[model samples]
Target: MLKLFEIVEDKSPKDRIDELRKDIERYNYYYYTKNESLVSDIEFDKLLKELEELEKKYPEYKIENSPTNYVGATSLKESKFKKVVHKKPMLSLNNSYNITDVIAFTERVEKNIDSVQNELEYVLELKLDGASISVTYENGELLRAVTRGDGVEGEDVTENILAIESIPNFLKEAVSLEVRGEIVLPLSRFKTLNEERLELGEEIFANPRNAASGTLRQIDSEIVKERGLDAYFYFIVDAEQYGFKTHKESLEYLEKIGLKTTGVADLITDMSIMEKRIAFWEAEKENLDYETDGLVIKLNDITLWEEVGYTTKSPRWAIAYKFPAKQVTTELLGITWQVGRTGKVTPVAELKEVELSGSKVKRASLHNMDEIIRKDIRVGDRVFIEKAAEIIPQVVSSVKEVRTGAEKEVVVPTNCPVCNSVLEKEDGLVDLKCVNPSCPAIIQGSIEYFVSRDAMNISGFGSKIVERMLQLHYIKDITDIFELHQHKDELMTLDKMGEKSVEKLLGSIEKSKSRPYSKTLYALGIPFVGKFLGDVLAKKSKSIDVLASMSKEELLEIDGVGEKVAESVYNYFRDEKSLEIIQKLKSFGVNFGKVAEDKKDEVKVEGKFTGKTFLFTGKLQKFKREEIKDLIESLGGTNLSSVSKKLDYLIVGEDAGSKLKKAEELGTVKILTEDEFLELTKE
Candidate 1:
């Protein structure tokens, strides 16, 4: 995306080679030293390959320290950690994006060595997507840990590495050796870390790999420990010195020494079986707790590795079979500003349809105006988009290499797109908010959230029905839902609203009034007050009136209520509009806190699910996710946000992913199916 120079027909090969070298060096510095990826792997490889071809063509332009000849950029001159020279240069593996190249690599290995008497054995292991590090052990105790900086030298990260619980401080055996592996943050931990950063208005990491790398480079080891980093050892620096005859044997020895290997590898004699395994892993890797970009194919025989030696930057005995590209370039058509229920405005980019990672993505998130300006993205320009964590599609950068004069700058709007009210920007925050409480979009979103399943459990109040009701002037705020029975006869005359349907709708509204105080607090749609926080506030305050009467200092005294949340709740109750709506709801007989106290007495404290913590992952068939969570709560069970040792049961459904794997690995969680969960709920 960031080109070093402009392309022209008359540009000489010498000049182009120079440009490519500078560009690749800059990318390397960002990637290795700063833990930031300015361009996708595909783009970086494209530049490197072009430079490699040019350097090979014109020997006069070749340089000794070119990026094509190095594993990564050198450690920063101002690095905090001391530099350590690797005992053996940590070379990178040649990357192959297709199966054909992998097969050719094996053929090349065979051709390089003398005629083989038997079939060659190969080891296939998942290529971890994270930061590379080498660890040395002296007499089985950890001596030091270093990053893979410029292959020959690296910075010491022993303090941060020691924080990881998985990497053992002392090995099982007292032999001295250095092992190489990847330092990765689990996907589950990555998601939680990002969520926490987002709440604090900090820039979220693009993916788990970046998060892990950044955490590893932290000046304070306490921050690194809090992030939950993990490592998997795969390669011994010198296998023959350790009496390992085969690659598989080396892995086994590492595991025997109390080191964690990938735990997924296969020894195959047939190329076809290796290809099949690659295909299988391409799909299965999606369910893994850690991110893996592809599979690393290595010759099983450590004896042959010396004969089929190293290139300038990569090892000849192994090649990385990378998966299909997850990033693609497409034309940016336009940007649309969307207002969320919290009034924060976000920019959405409409792009030309492009297939990425097996799905057609036509739109991506621009995040905010600051991101648009930072990336220099413009309409009618080519932009790169990638699915972050294989979930949310987002604009990564703009391809300034192909920009034309027709491209126009993306302008920030001064007013709300839907309500035409002035937008407000808060200090120290990148987001612009619409402070107009009466804005149509805000009102609509609030009412919709008020009747959501996790909130009031009100049925027959889908988005369409809410929109239609608003259009007909039958509802203006959340209070109108409680007073809907007054317009029942008028509602019966509407389309598909015959007598029975109208009666059922009114009954649902009445039923919602009996929901617990925690649900009511969440349904208020206060910013930052999620279900967990809502529960905390409800238990501490006991009643909505008492909560409103409390000062900010008193609100801060409540457990789990941070400064931001306390400020928001304190301000919300003081607003005239919100107070007016609360009064109207009281007149309509909506439950505020009395019903919650009465219901607390009736809860099944001695139910079968009592004293247990539960979590549900993947898609359910019989009950909706929120419905099942509410059921668990009613039966005296707690719903956790993630998989941990505290969890008692993990309810899994179709296509269960990392949570299921993590729960199984913990070995203390009881995994249950949908039918099994239902059976437990029965009296």
Candidate 2:
């Protein structure tokens, strides 16, 4: 294994870079080709970072085999599959790690084209971290799937690539051309595959990228289909040959040809706006299902691309401004155990504050005691942490190499941290749960979950209010929420719960009673059940009493209800305490079944809204978005989230976004103001 601190200072930078490159090449082959990693990703990253830095210091010494020359894997091929040459060679992008590097790249572009920064319209795309693939379509039929091998020739994996759901088997335009895309394994699918691997006693993939790469190289196409690989096309071969002039136009062409491209690329001229967009994406990237390592910024003009041309490798028109590595090293101050609504105890890392992506992060989830043991993380240890979804801070690995004797092993608690109750571990489950149903932390967590947006959606009832109410003994269980009107005088005595706030909070609780019965089912925190499953259960069982009596076999009759969800829901409703709470809620006039709608449907009525497709964006002064959607549906109209060529009308509200512009760009849809929409709806 290689170590960063072991580099010999006496060796010249060039000499060390050569050694590091050799080591990296050997490791990359072992990791990518052999799927056997000799060093941790952090250690490998350190070597690559050093080699990259040294290459800048001594560019002349950078050889053809330098690891930094490639976008993903340097070499991956299945010899049985025939090889094909790319129509126009696939290109890689130069990487920029920080804002200063981006600025330098910006300045270089301005100098190269003799255009001011504002004059250049730059388009930014998500740099999907996966295997690059090129596919050709001749007269709307599939040709071959080419890997971006050495950026020139690649193996033909058409059989396997054809199985991907998102890839088009035939093009809509019937054009004889080639398209390039990145094949990715979504994060959710990756987790599912890992769980399946663990169950089957197989070697788990190290990351989503590895899984995607390995899956594409598999001999059996059936395995590829089972893995659910997806692609997003980014480029076209000799796009000028196809009459596309701009990068954005090329992307739109790809979409028009029945191929999937990622959501629209943002066009920007101002550097400040571009940087802000980058920062926004850096924070929001976690929300995406696919793994995106950075944004690929390209000159939107195709003429500039011809002038910028190629450098034996990457296109000069583009550079990838990589986000701060998801993995970063920080010191762990300590660990705290938190009890969730389900009584699962999770370890949270208290960190020496570090900025990740964009914001200051001081905490990361340890997940469970099993994770702590697997990573060998300890208090006072230097740990590698990253956002799992650009949202959840996760401990990736511990820096054992840099650990001092002072670091202490983390002790897993046998008792609940919040309440002094002995924990119980179910057979085959890694979680240690506080089975004490009366635990304060569990109660509060359940209450918080019950009032959450996708649950009962009780506005003005936040975590702080729950905490204060708990302290004041104003509530003990979920049923008590509906009875809060009786405590209005008592609530007003507390901090911030003045007359207006109290009224608003009570009003929200009252309003929550009218929420669909499925929401209440979700809010109860039935183990292994969510809003979707709640809706499923509600569809099957009409009332809370019937739901309580539902058998596992009866529950399984519902589509999408599996054995686990069925058992959880069955056991929960049958529990005495659960039944008592339900009985109380029913007595309090809560919706025991689907809440009936207030507005009567005008059956057999004819109007302009009938049979028309409508899309809404921004704030509506006259109606809530949901209310409008309901009204639209009631009047035989369809409401959509996005703009399309088929869209008939767009109801413009205040502060409309890109959807409005997209609608205008299509030039077929009617744009209606709020006043016009209201007039049309008037009886």
Candidate 3:
């Protein structure tokens, strides 16, 4: 935790270098072996730079096997994966997030090649945001597949590789060569897999990249096969052995031999043309099947690539042009407030139109009064805006340098922005909300919620339709949706709503009346009451009347129903508006008393697995990790996020890491394989 300044203050040059080397080594171990990082990449780079500088000044201290010599720490020790030394080190590319660094990269390339910028050919490829893998072939037949563990030695995952249908077992031409590529889970396939998992009552993957990485590491090849992973060969490890003169030729040859390559790779002679192509891809990246964070540009000519050489980690011939961070600096023109269905008023910063990521931005959320005060953000101030994960717009910080006295201070309103109703806050709540049940924002939000896919699931009903319905006064309360059939002629006259469309809309609304009890409960938009909880409540209630009659203490008796959730439900049912809505829904034949058939009792148990905690490490052969976790949770067991002395069981699988060592140290924690754990469950 020592700062660089504190460490180097009184130390000798050699001592400072040694300290840096040791510190970085420790960090690398934690990052690579423990799957945890204590320091940011920027901080690591600063230490590395200091070490490199000291070593350069005092040549004697330039020790071999220094952290500078290695690309990264590997994950090959004490695991099941076989090790494969790369034929040619799969060097990484130096990345640039801005045009200045890219221009400098081109300048460096031109200097090394002794040629004009336009004279050199560059092979530009989309940088797939997935795990890097090296596949070696023997006489056109499949041999081994290795992950890029540390650029030197890597873990062999041949069995897992074979599961990918896109990768040919044998190439068209008989040749022995090593090819390097990225393993990716296509976005569509990723979504489908998540949907399937959700249906099976399993945890869903966060992203396609993580899904692909997890799939590759899974011990069960059948699971991998069903998930549908893909690979795109980018480079022949030793290009000269394949008789390829240019990078473009090698890629073409890979495709010719029935090995897949990214279809987006382009060979360009002009730098400006390359820039334009990169710009085009950056803007349209959302449409790509697999995730790509950036573009990799390499010298097209093999001889030039060789001459350019490589640094300690990255090849000099290639550089990754990373997409600009979603953040952008713009002038804050004004501040506006928006009230959501939950009655939470959020401050939105209206900005001078600026391009961020791929879209033109004008407004971003300031979150709340605390955020506004903390940042001291004001109107007419130049503010830095970032799209949180390239989606929600957020104001990161404001530039105080440009803030003039003319800038107005932002004030949190005491009244609702839409309905002008007095704002009130709950005892333990941070958000100020309009307590009025008929608040415009609340009404709109409730209507939107009732018609959502997980609720009444009305087809052809969306944001635009809701807005139009509100505007036309077709429905005031959510219950008025049932009376929509009476306004058939009015709906038919509205824009984009003809007789056929109105009929379809009415049919969807009519069909929604028979939605299951759990879905109707969720559609009520009660605080802390999610679809899963709604299902639990519906299974327990069997009737809306029974649910309404239940006391707070009675509601709290249900498992996973915390005090806040129980109180919210109890209070909701006791409300006059809620009672009226329930009566109206009942009168309309909406299925509010019918519970869907499910194995709701399976997850509630007190036998063998009760109060037991399980931590899964490495990989499992018999079942996917998620499936095992689900099984543990279903049997009254908790899934531990990390290995500790408190862990009751550590499920060790293939390529187990530091968690295994920690469990061994703990001694009290029981370690079990997938089959052994299954046997224990049978008891």
**TM-score for each predicted model, relative to the true structure:** 0.43, 0.45, 0.46
Q: Model 2 scores what on Cα lDDT?
A: 0.77
Clashes of 3: 0
Error of 1 at 406 (Å): 2.0
lDDT of 1 by residue, 131-249 (tens): 99999999999999999876666889999899999999999999888899999999999889879868854446667876787677776688788889999999997675455678999
| Model 2, position 660: C-alpha lDDT score | 72
Predictions: Cα RMSD each: 25.5, 24.6, 25.7
lDDT of 3 by residue, 620-663 (tens): 66765558866886677766555555579988766555567768
Which candidate gets the maximum lDDT versus the true structure? Answer: 1
TM-score-wise, the better of 1 and 3 is 3
Local error of candidate 1 at residue 148 (angstroms): 38
Report the C-alpha lDDT of model 2 over 194-264, residue by residue, as the tens digit.
89878854446677887798778766688789999889999887665455557899998888888888874
Alpha-carbon RMSD, candidate 2: 24.6
In candidate 3, which residue pairs clash? none
What lDDT does each candidate get? 0.80, 0.77, 0.77
Alpha carbon deviation, residue 108, candidate 1 (Å): 48
| Cα displacement (Å) at residue 32, model 3 | 40
